[model samples]
Target: MPQDCERTPVVRDNGRHQWEKDRARAPRTVRATTGATERDTGLHPPDLVFHAEYRELPAPCPLAEAFGVPAGTLLLERSYRTRYGPESAPFALVTSYLVRGMIAANPDLLDATNEPWPGGTQSQLHTVGIELDRVEERLTARAPTPAEARDLDLPSGAPVIQLRKTSYDIDDRVVNIADVTLPADRTELLFTTRLERW
Candidate 1:
């Protein structure tokens, strides 16, 4: 997050010419039904390829308003949509989402940490997640290849973001699950963290 870190246009918007068209280039293929499903047959992959449907989250849930964050923050939310085929049931396992807070910009945060490689902009909290040389907060326990952009569940396009997270299930006095880990191979799992910005 630099002092001038800027927003990039998403492929879906008109901002990127040919982007939307490129993303939707080919329709997913549907396999023809093998008479087996009609008979008392064994299981098989669906005749239709798996797909996801997104309905943008409504304005402010209780959890969001509690923070009193600003407007136009890019919010991430877990969807409960259903489907029958794919590499796996990718979305159901997610427990949280991310939304940009409505706060003024700050990029001087770049030089504060011990990260060896401070990527392009090291100012914003969310973008800071990727800029880190590696996880040092003890929270970033899982590591995956950069190419494993799985969370969006879309078939193509470079994900605008990537995240690695760990969760703590605190119940009363005992820590039942300390830093229970969750990685967004396809969809990011965004929970609140106590770390400072940048």
Candidate 2:
């Protein structure tokens, strides 16, 4: 990590801006996801590298319950890591799941190579005709596992923030679920809510 590295502040108040499209932007290695948001922390998109691993597997019990699907339902599992430059540790570890049957309508959604998908997951869902309604996120903190500590290069005894994000579609169906592990030392969460006048 660079000595000048700043904590990555995740602004929850931004709402669904990641799902919005920017037509005038040029094609680049980074897309409008977490990587794009890192710019707010002084990280340049060109210096970030994203890696994704995709697989199809049976949904675990908890995931099945969340998706309202039977156990053993096939799901597309995506593991993501975005590192700043070549020598630094990943900003965070993200594992996202989507029901295979629901997204199978679009063949490209089944492939990981198509990722860093221009407008992120929302755009991919759009191709399958699913529109997002809202997203819910739950946060917790815990000591990192040995592997997590090694991957995120955390100091001894440092804790990590776990975020579970669930996305629902227009029909109120759970469309996606993601588990994100952020290094507490380098991650910040900000949330803002507006109150309507009485």
Candidate 3:
């Protein structure tokens, strides 16, 4: 997809020009110089679409433990699956959590129908006057559950890389947490940090 502000032709209605987003293009997760998935391997971009939905939980789960929240705390859980073109396997599975109380001021944030938000979570938080300061990701690898293996179409013995991403605001309060599952054979993780010289 053209990255640098490629404009689609305007359509006219009642002699008024209307701008429409190009929906055929695959959705992107983050900014990348090349392709989003090619940071380490220069892999070609796959035809992909991201599907997301809100999950209802009866009680606090692992996410609550990671966030140090009390059990049974109500959280907004959003689950995502990215699938490649004409393929039964998914590129990855990702789920994100946010405290419902933190964003209750913006009713739009609570609805799944408003998802695939134009600017992602940062934009969503901006609506509520929150600014993100930094993000941290913890990583681990493990065997997939039988259901995961079936969903990902992994070969026997294939591992999956799991990531727990935490986002903090300028006040240093946790704003968001995300769990990601990546097919070990096709995914890569890269981290860069800058340091000041003495």
The best candidate by TM-score is 2
Give the CA lDDT, 0 to 100, for residue 180 in model 1: 19
Task: Please list the residue runs of candidate 2 whose C-alpha ends up more than 4 Å from where it truly belongs after superposition.
Answer: 1-36, 39-42
Indicate which candidate wins on lDDT: 2
Residue 53 displacement in candidate 1 (angstroms): 2.7
TM-score of each: 0.21, 0.85, 0.72
Against the reference, the lDDT scores of all candidates come to 0.27, 0.78, 0.64
Write the candidate numbers in order of decreasing TM-score.
2, 3, 1
Please tell me which model should have the higher lDDT, number 1 or number 2.
2
Candidate 2 accuracy as lDDT: 0.78
Least well predicted 10-residue stretch by lDDT in candidate 2:
17-26
Residue-by-residue lDDT tens digits, candidate 3, 1-198? 212322221111211100111111224443222232232233334444557799655336677776667778788888877554456666677889998877889998888887656546766777798777677778899999998878777777889888787888889888889887877765645444447999
Q: Model 2: per-residue lDDT, tens digit, 1-198?
A: 553556344433344434343421434343543444464356666667879999999998999999999999999999998876764678889999999999998999998898767667777787888888777889999999999999988877889999998989889999999998988887767666668999
